[model samples]
Target: MSFTSARPEDLLIDAARRGDVPYLQQLLADGTVDVNVQNGKGFTALIVAAYDDQVEATKALLAAGADPNVQDVSGNSALMGVSFKGYPEVARLLIQHGADLNQQNGNGGTALMFATLFGRHNIVPILLEAGADTTIRDVRGLSARDLAVQQGNEEALKLLPQE
Candidate 1:
C-alpha cells in the first residue's frame, strides 16, 4: 500500500524500523500518533525499534511515553527483543524506560534467558544489574545459568551466579 493509505501509526513504526530518526522525531512531535500503537504482530513502535537495533528511534519512542513493557503477540517485550538480538545498549535503554527485566515470553523466557540462550554476553550483565531474576525458569525449566551451560555460552556461564 502507498504511504498515504497507511495508518499514521504504521508510518511511525516504519520510521522506527528504518532508523529514520528525523521522521520519528516529527511523528512523535505531532503528538497524535500513539507511540505504543501495535502492528499486526502486536509489536509497538518501541519494540520494533529495539528489535531493529534502532537506538535513536528507541530513545525517541521511550521519550514519547511508549510502554517498554508492552509485549508482542508472542509475549516478547522490547527488552527481550533487544536482548535476543545481542543489542545491549537498546536493552539497557528499554530497562531504563521501565521494561520488566523478568518478564517471561510465550515460551516463559525472560530477557535474561534470551541473552543466555543467544550467548549475548554483553547483555547478561546489564540484565543482571537491572535486577533480572536468575532463578527464574523457562518452559523447559531452564534458568539463565542452565541455558548458558546448555548452550555452551562460556562467557555467560562465567557471569552467572553459581548454583
Candidate 2:
C-alpha cells in the first residue's frame, strides 16, 4: 500500500478519535486508508480507539484485522491503554481478538499492572482470565499485586490473584 503521505491515514485516525463510526467505517471499507496505518507516534486505529474510548471503533478495527499487540513508538499496546483508562468492554474485545495479555509497556508495565495502578478493579479479573501474567515484575521488581498493596488500593488488592 503506497501513499502520497500519511495525510489520508491521519484523517481516518482523527475520525476514529471523534468516534465517527460511519466515516471510519466508510474509510475502512474504501480500502484507500491503511487499516493498520500508524500515525507519527505509531498509534494504529485500534490504539486510537482504545485511547478515545470508542468501543465500536475498537471492535471494528479488530474485526478488520488490526494487530491488537502492535505497539506505538513508546511500546504502548491497545490493551495497556484500555486498561489504564478503565475501559472494560474495549479491553475485553481486544483480549477476545488476541491482544497480548502479558505484554509489558514502554515502562515495563503490563495491562494488569496498569489496571491495578489506576484502580481499575473491574479490569483485573478480565486480564487474569485472558492469561495476564500475575508474576510479572516491572523494572523495579514490583508485581501488579505489590503495586496495589503499596498504593493501599484495597479494591484492586482483592481483585488481584494472590501469590
lDDT of 1 by residue, 15-55 (tens): 88898989988887888787888889998888888999999
Which regions in candidate 1 have their CA more than 4 angstroms from the true location? 1-5
lDDT per residue (tens digit) for residues 3-116 in model 2: 544576987788778878888888888888888899889999789988889988887788788899999998889999989889899998998899999998777899999999
State candidate 2's TM-score. 0.91
Q: Which segments of model 2 are wrong by more than 4 Å?
A: 1-6
lDDT (CA) for every model shown?
0.88, 0.87
Best by lDDT: 1
C-alpha RMSD in Å of predicted model 1 compared with the true structure: 1.7
